[model samples]
Every structure is written in C-alpha cells, then in structure tokens.
Target chain A: MPQLALNRLRERGSTERAALDALLDDVLAGTLSTVVDGKPWVVPMLFARQGDRILLHGSTGAGALRHVAAGAPAALAVIAVDALVVGHTTFDSSANYRSAVVHGTLTPLPDRERAEALDALSERILPGRNAEVRPMTRQEQAKTLVMAMPIVDGEFLVKTRSGTASPPDEHTDAWHGVVELRTVALDPAPAPTSTAEEVPRSVLDFAGARVLA
Target chain B: MPQLALNRLRERGSTERAALDALLDDVLAGTLSTVVDGKPWVVPMLFARQGDRILLHGSTGAGALRHVAAGAPAALAVIAVDALVVGHTTFDSSANYRSAVVHGTLTPLPDRERAEALDALSERILPGRNAEVRPMTRQEQAKTLVMAMPIVDGEFLVKTRSGTASPPDEHTDAWHGVVELRTVALDPAPAPTSTAEEVPRSVLDFAGARVLA
Candidate 1:
C-alpha cells in the first residue's frame, strides 16, 4: 500500500516478513495509531504475535479500540533501540534500531477466542507462566477486548539501522562510535510478605538472551 | 479538550504540567501520530523538551513530518517501561510504566531559531557532546527540519502505573514481583581504526541515570 512506503532513508526499510515478525516478537509494547472521532490518537499497548497476526489487548470500553473495531484504519509500530551512533558532526549522528510498522483495520476477536488469546499473550510475554497462573474467570474474559490485525497486503514495513557512525565529511574528525543500548531484566523484586518463589526458566532466558540486541 | 480525555482507565490520566514536562524530558523518543491523506500514520521520533514545548527533528523530506507541518492534528506519546509485574494469576500481571500523551499541531521552527533548537536537542540527547562536535553547516541546517509542539491548550495527559501486581483472587499463589527493565549503555564501540575518545560526561550521566525509574 502507498501508506506503507518509507519515503526517506529508503535503504533502512525492509519488506521481509521474518524481520517483521521477529521485531514484533521482541518488543513488549507498540504504539497503536488510529483516527478517533475525526482526530488521530495513539496509545501504548502490550502486544504479542501469534502465527501471522498480531494480538492486541485492551478494555472493551477503550475509545480508540472501539473506533478501531468500527473499521477505522490503524497503524501499529514496535521499535527496539540497540545503540546510539555518535558522529563527529551532529547531522550524521543517529541510533541503531529495529522498527516494525503495520497498517490495517483491526478485527476484534470473537468472545469464544478471548480466553485462548489471553493465554497465548501470557505465554508470549512470560513464556512459562501461562500454566502457573490461575485460569482467567468468565467475568474477567468478558471485560477484556482482544484485537487481531493480520500481516498481509504489503501493509507492513520493518526497518533497521545498525553499526558505527560514518558521515561523508572530510573536515570533521571528532570521536565517532556507537554505544550499545539494551533492555535487561533485573532481579525480580517480590512484594512485601510474599513468599520467595522460584524464578522461572523463561525469566532467566529473557534476562540473559539480550533479545533487543 | 474532549479529545485528550482518557475514556478508559480515566483514573490513570493526569493534568499537572510539572509531571508532564518531567516525563517529556526523561524519554528520548516518542511516537508522533498524525493523519495523512485521511489515514493515520505513526512514526518514532527523537524529541526533547524546551521549556513548555517539545522539539522534534527529522529530514525535511520525511512524509510524516511534512504531514505534521501541514497542520494535521498530532498526538505524541512517550512511554518508559519501568518493570514487568509477574503476578500469581495471569490476569493480575502487568507492567509498571510512565506515559505522556500530547495533542497539538506542530509549528515549524524558523531559520533564526533552528540553530538554537538543534543545539538544544543535541544537548538533551547526548548531554555534553554539543561542545565536542563541530558546528553544523548551513547546508546541513537547510536539510533538517525542526518542529515544536507547545504543551498548552489542555491537550495533554500523563498516565503512570507502578508497583507490584496484586491479583484479586487470593487463592492462587504463583510467583509475584516486578522484573525491572532499563536501557543501559554498554561500553562505547569506537569506529574501526578511529582514535579512542573518552565518553562524554553527558553520555556518562545518561548511562548512569536511571531516567525511567
């Protein structure tokens, strides 16, 4: 679609589905953009990728989601910043990042599939905790809204920038390099008087994997 | 403005300006949302707060910035994810995060103020590096676009969720706590065969300061 076209820095944009899915799976949240009541609105949402579609969760009463379910066009963007590229000149400086942008109309999941979507979301976020946590109640399921936006129709763009700064200038010779940026999981801080439970293998993996890098 | 009202989870929204500016200063990037050709578009942008306004930078040729400059109503959202709350039940699990959403029309900076704005942005993101780097050429200045969005008009909302997860059901006792998430600076990776320069004090401060927490 014309909307998915990357106008500037075209070299950074990618059409690969693998890169798009990998980026969607890597970041915890994305900014969902939609037109609501004749104005643009954006909100941060916790999301997960299941099969070929992205699952977004929110309260059924959210105005943005309500507008989205009513067929307002939407865009979801997930970005994972890897490092800061410091260049000799200010114009050449930038950041190394992986970004996935998807445009489509959201299809609200049926009531019967909300429970499964929730479990899948839990599994994607906290890998092994789906089985450990108590089952979601019928009332709880009724209160939530799950949205699925399929990855198709060339509506997605994945762009990444990595490596050291290299500006094509002869006079500038300050320091040029990249300082890595990463999202690291720290030790879990338990609530007061709560039992010290064993940390799950998934938490360990998430902490050690350097997934954003 | 009714457009800025937080329809769902209205309790999390804030009207205080100090809290709003503090959040605007802490985060480095935000998703700038605007309507282009009657469709919603969201793009990640590096931004800085200058007094009561937010400064956003991009190439002059960028389509999204072009749209914003053309008077499309915009929403800029900055979110810092502090931790992952792992709870006894999946339903109770969530994240501790601080978010600020600003709705406004962008005002393009004049040629007279572009230099000052560019310096302000560099100082905000890289801290001390502005002094170390060479001055931008007039050609470079012409190629860049700086737009400022004022934080006035009651079109702003700051929402925050912090603390450990507390599942409503008492019977289920899985693990419960928060795993902190942070953006840390690793050792600077200098360009190949480049002279090693000391990391700037601003960068050091950025690396040391837990801005999200």
Candidate 2:
C-alpha cells in the first residue's frame, strides 16, 4: 500500500498486511470506541472483511450507530484472546496478552452494498451461515444498517506479544511469575447409539480448548 | 439500575449491572479496543482493579496509548470466553459466545498518580505480583503511563446469547453444529530434571495445559 493509502496505521510502521489480516479473519466481532462531546463510549459488535473493507452493522435506533450515522467520527476494532503471562523473573510480575491494534473509520455503507457486508459478517463468524439463516426480512433489513472501512496496508498495524511478566534486569528473585493456561474440550462428543465404535470425524475435528496461563 | 445510568445499554429499558460487575472482576487484560482518526484499533494489554477503578497501561509512546492520550475516546473491556451450547440445530444455526464491554475516557495518569495506577494494573494481572519486581524504576515509571476509568454501573451491560444454532423453533438436524475452541500458548517455563513431582500448586495445577495458551 502507498503512503497516503496507509494513513490509519502509520504508528505501527510495518510492511506486512497479511499478518494482521489473519488475526482479523479468526475473530468474528469487534468492540467499537469513540468520543462524543468528551465522554467515551464502547460497544461490542459483529463485523466482516471483504478484501480490505471491514463491514459492521447496528439496528436503526442503536444509539452508537445512529450517532455515527449522523456523521460523528468513530473508531472500530477487533481482538483475539491469547494466554495470560505470569513471569518467573518477579513473583509479582505476571502479564496476560494476545494480538491487537488495527483501526479504521466507521462509514455508512450504501444500500446496494448492504447484503455483501452482512454476508461477510456472518461468514466471518461461521462459514456457510448465510445459507442457513432465513433471509433478512425487508423490514428487518430496513431497520438495520452497515458500515465499511478499508484495513489495507499501512492503514492498520497488528501487534501480537506474549511472555510472562519479567522483573527488571536488576531484580534477581528466587521465584518466577506464571502465565496460567486452561484448556477445556467439548463434553466428549457422544457417539450415536447405533454407530458402535465409529465416531464422526467432525466430532474429532472440532474439539474445544481454552488455554490461559 | 436507572435508565439514565445504563446510558446506551437499555434494550428492555433495564440494566444487568450485577452480572456485568462479576464479569469485570474476572475479565482478563487482553480485551481492550481503541480508535485513531476514523479506524478502530484492538490491543491485548495489562490490567488491574483497585476498588472501582480499572487500570491499564503500556509503553508511553505505543500507538494505542498515544492515540488515547491525544483525547481519542478509548474503551477497556473484559470478555469471558464462556460455554459451548449444542442444539439439535445444524452447524448453520449453532452458535457460541462470550461477554464483556467497557466504555471509558482514556486519559494519562497525572505524573503524581502514576504509581497508584501502575500498582493497580500490575496486581490485577496476577494477585500477588505488585511488589515482586524492582520497585518501578524512575525511568521505567516515567516511561510507562497508566489510564484509569471507573466501573460505572449504569453504562454497563452483560450480554449472553449463546447455544447451538438451531432453526427458529424446533427442527432437529442429523448433525448438530458442535463447536471446538483452540488456543495457542506462548513460551513455556523449562521443566527441571533435578526436581521430581514436587512442584508448586500453581505450576502443577495448569501443567497439563499450555504454559501460555
């Protein structure tokens, strides 16, 4: 991306957009933050990415949505959860973290582009999801609105950092900090009674694990 | 809670402030989002709770921090990766989710209040960690800046919409959309050959899981 093209993510100063794109792909929704008259407001919302354009939506009367629709400048973002880092250098130095820091403006998408944005948002969370849901009703569709922003090249920066909290180099304590990680699997997918020992590969393929240490 | 207090979270014109508070108590630091110009930025960070004050911090010149200090509205959020719900619903209808949203003005701690904010931020990540490292070096303390926001009751809302995605009413499918979650851990502490099974409870408790998932 060119210099003017990378306007939003200038502080990150990176050459790779793919790294941040992958992180955004795995996460479904994002939390939006903006200042209105000096007071701050945050909202959690769903989103989608089409090439470099990020699509997000809200109900007709959603205050934040309406506020931005009225032309207020707004900020939108997404994040992935990683583990908590508790370091060994200092018993008290433990930090938990993951990837973050990509930004873009929230602009009202045109009606002609609405369907694509919605589809993108749905697919971002669950593949093939649009095919499954009843199509958006005309009235429902009318009540909702979508916005898109390009997250291309220099427009965004993706930062992913990990490691336990470490004591300053000067401190040499006997104990170390810890990063606690916990992983949980779906209740073992029970085999169908008629299947005997045959287990569905889907069950084997999709297991749950939540690790945060 | 009163409607005015809930600010924008009033769907039924009521507040779920209690649940929201509990979520905050256990919310990890990795869930914060910010904005720059028109784009949204997401970042995983360190956090702490001191009474009603929620603390967060980073390199003073970090892109996210710089943006916030410049008077851009910021939000500190805590999302709990909750449960997996399975319905007789198809993969299309199956759904799973977590909960959290915190909106607040992000301001640098005045030079005089820096120590308190940093203390709270460090302790929040690991319960007994505040005093383990060398006391914040004058330079380290100067280099790091903290932001504090009150846990307002009304502006808070805890949303829980999760389960196996199913048809509107009841249409059982042959294969339900069973969700499997995956988390990757960062670096792990080296295990010592000299020691046998004698390990601290914290290390032993989460040993089977990733060291920094």
Model 1 lDDT tens row, B1-213: 011112355677778898888888877667888888778888776778999898887778887778788788999887777777777677777777778789999988999999988888887778788887678778878887888998895899888777776644575445677787877778777787356466666567666765341
Q: Give the per-residue lDDT digits (tens) of candidate 1, residues A36-82.
A: 76688888777889998888878887766788877789999877767
Tens digits of per-residue lDDT for model 2, A42-145: 66655556787777666656776667666565555554545444444222343332344455567787877766666566555445544544555455455556
Candidate-wise lDDT, in order:
0.75, 0.50
Off by over 4 Å in 2: A1-15, A69-72, A88-98, A107-113, A129-143, A163-213, B1-14, B30-44, B59-74, B81-100, B103-119, B130-142, B162-167, B170-188, B191-213
Q: Chain B alone, TM-score of each model?
A: 0.88, 0.66
lDDT per residue, candidate 2, B21-66, as tens digits?
5656655443565555454455555465667766766666566567
TM-score for candidate 1, residues paired by index: 0.92
C-alpha-based local distance difference test score of model 1: 0.75
**What are the runs in model 1 whose C-alpha is more than 4 Å off?**
A1-7, A200-205, A211-213, B1-7, B196-213
